[model samples]
Target: MPSPAAPAHPAHLSPALTLLLATATGLAVASIYYVQPLLGLLSAQFGVGSASIGLLPTLTQLGYAAAILLLSPLGDRFDRRRIILWKAAALVAALAFAAWAPGFGALCVASVAIGLMATLAQDLVPAAATLAPEAERGKRVGQVMTGLLLGILLSRVAAGSLAAVAGWRAVYGSAAVAVAALMPLLWWRLPRFVPATQAGYGELLASMGRLWLQHAPLRRAAMAQGLLSVAFSAFWSTLALVLAGPDFGQGSAVAGAFGLAGAAGALAAPLAGGMADRRGPQAVIRVAALLVFLSFAVQAVAPASLWLLVAVAVVFDLGVQAALVSHQSVVYSLDPASRSRLNAVLVSGMFVGMASGAALGSSLLAAFGWRAVPVLGAVAALGAVVVSRHGRRA
Candidate 1:
């Protein structure tokens, strides 16, 4: 199975294949996030404070960032389907270790491994782009991204609800089972993708730096996504703390329920893709940035209202998802041969920003409470807008 007989480059993805990629991307990405809403429960179980537990999400994202840099580029040098299958197997093992970790240190290490293996989704994204027609590329990427975002949002809900009934470890256990189940589906349906580059591992890694230096539009797209990621991470990373605090006194389930609100953002993705197709990605990105910036301000207006907070979640998610699709549309069109490496460079920045945001959001919530989160997130969203504006001029 290591070197299966396959075409140099398979035919374009059928709609069924496209749907498989979207579902696979979603499931794979979800592995890195199942612990989010479970953060409160894990904190109590591990005897850690809110601020300290932030390392869990931060380290997970850092691990993901590292995978994007180190592993995602390998897709361009090897068969992508093989990469996805082997990574999924590794992810199953990582999830099981996380479910059975005996201490905080063990759990933290497992979390990092889980995140690293979750880069299978990164592999699939570019593979999808490679299999689509240029005219349909944006739409296809948008659909895949919608699945990815839904996985992230729904993961919280599933983890929280499962933890409420079965315990924190149960969430990870279920995740392991889900990934194992997905393996057979992918093994049967996923098509092989030949390497576009004959570069060795060393050269593949080196080219990412060169790609960054060579492409200005790539730089703009990456910077904008990174800044927006800071805001997105800020909200999700801190929401559990805020809900469990004195005002709400709710458990993890409440945090998970809020994910439903954010799911509204998924609706904006197809629209953003179509808009990017019609008016250009930059135009769509501009609107996305403004929406995110405004969501933060609206959040500040009703800091203590739960229903209003839910509405803010919806608006913010919409903005973030829209910008993400637009950004991918821009960069994916830059170089088809470099799609995996390009996406690796782009999303790697976003994860770094996510890690930073998680750490920053935790500190702010621990110190000043909920009010500070929106303030900081707004600043980050506005930074994205500035980057987009600059990109327009350049």
Candidate 2:
């Protein structure tokens, strides 16, 4: 039997198709984040404690994590296009349901459903990787990732603006309408591809464990990105509190506006992809590590001017996102048949890192001060640099 890792040179994906895939991925993934900026409004409307309302985003993350582990591997055992379409449909329904949900309990259920189906982004990413030639694989994945990043950064903007104008529920309603409209475009444009693996569902899932134990490159890529994610999460998680301190005396709105600066950094995704193609993904990761380290180092030295902090957000996102694209490029190259499962493992690790970083960042900020937060970020990025360097030598 021929190896699945051997290049097939898939020629069906056109530029138009690629754009649609990227857009679809961006829109699908945005659903999980829309609630973050509306938590206070949700608490007021639902007559709930702010602490209880926090469960909306928490459950969404939990659902997304579970879906990545459970549903993502199905792409290898079935048709990826079908998986994407089915999940997109579920996502549309979930969004609409959340919009109309009568109470907190119903909204919580809908939020989980939305998260579970948001794996559509995960499915599209691996599909893009599989469709591109080995030489251009990083570039293609980067294109899709750029959209994914834009969606994450912009979702807060859209949600906050819409909530101000209409109300919190209107945000979800608008998203549902947009997603419903996107379904036909996806159905019309998506290219279908058959899976090579004939393994039963149970066996397919079991193989994920074997793949983890078997591939050194996969493990390295996951570890490197996971560490970088810790730094990324640490910054964003405590940013609002830091801004609210006496020196800054800003509010969450100011913190939210900083996402626009971060969006500027996502533009590097395609460029990083192209570099990974030419110089190898490891080289891109090396540059990314250095950029992340420098971003924090500057923050530690320079006092926190708002403009300076904006620049820091841009630089920090640029480095972390570049490393992410480079890491995915390496993981996708490991096995053609297992790209989706590989992504599941790699992304799962990132989530774990983000959760840990959020908790640690919060603790550090409370115990010490805003000054302590950057030191934690710098140390985490330094850890990422060490891991990437070791991976390079390996």
Candidate 3:
């Protein structure tokens, strides 16, 4: 029998290619988060209650979760380059629709579409893993993850600042233009990926369930990371509301500026990746989760103190980003041939937690007030620590 066909177009990851992957991942994922800082503004403009406006991010994250489960696995069955380009075009359209949305209902529809298309970011990540040599996989994944983390953190800053000056619509318009410009560059640069499997789409998706069951580590990583995401998402989704309330008397710009505090988390990504490579991801996960728990616990005590909140943001953001990088390293190592499907399983869990957190954060904020938000985050993060430790013992 013929030797199994070598995975097609296998090439070492060049510096230029790494940079492209990182930039592409950042831009794509950023699209999902641009509405976060603008939630307060959106609530006011739409004349809706806090819980209702919170549904926007919840819908976007739910869309992302749906796409990760439904679309990301296709990378293993098709040329990732083709998938990226097609998704990029669709993402541009979605962003444009969001910008031109004439009503709150239209914007909600656009948010879901944007989340679905932004799974291109998920594609770029596994592509990075596929390109890198095994020894360098963790570090390279970390570098790409750094871009993803920065995109998430900085998008809030850009959206809030731009929304303050030009209105929220301008933020979406500019993002659409950015994604459009990115397409030609991606077309010119990204190499064609050899499809990893010829399995039909149904089989490909079914494989994800098998992978989840076959790999205990994958499940644990997904669970811990998912819990951490609850803390991270809850904090960000509710932050603007907390700042805008009578206690702080701030606006979107100030809310956006908080992203700068979390910039420290961006810097921590590569370090976390390297640490996972050196010490293993389990220790990293436990320590990182504890850090998140502690940071949020402190924030719960002094929720109204701006300076304390800034410090809490820096520490917790660092912990959350570190845990994510470590989790990716764990999942990517499990099944090389099924990297895309494995990632789909891992990130699907994460976005589910994000959707839950956004909804829960908004409800908690509305019912009990801002003080309750941090407590929810603290509880979720502590649960991550317990899960990580339980995985180790098992």
lDDT of 2 at 262: 80
Q: Tell me the deviation in Å of residue 20 in model 1.
A: 3.3
Q: What is the C-alpha lDDT of each candidate?
A: 0.86, 0.78, 0.87
Worst 10 residues of 1 by lDDT: 1-10
Clashes of 3: 0
Model 3 spans > 4 angstroms off? 1-14, 132-141
Best by lDDT: 3
Q: List the candidate 2 regions with Cα displacement exceeding 4 Å.
A: 1-11, 14-16, 39-58, 100-109, 128-142, 238-253, 277-280, 297-302, 359-375
TM per prediction = 0.93, 0.82, 0.93
As a whole number from 0 to 100, the lDDT of residue 99 in candidate 3 is 91
Question: Which 10-residue span in candidate 2 carries the lowest summed lDDT?
Answer: 1-10
Give the alpha carbon lDDT tens digit for every residue of 194-294 in model 2: 77678788887788788889998888777777777777766766665576668797654566576788888867655787889899999988888878888
lDDT of 1 by residue, 1-394 (tens): 5446444455566788788888888888988878778888888889988788988998899999999889987887888889888999999999999999999999999989988999989888877887888788767876787778788889888887888888989988888898898788777777677677788999998888999999999999889999999999988988887888887898888888888888876565668878888999999898888988898877866648888778888888888888988898889888977777898899999999898888899888878888888988899999999999998898
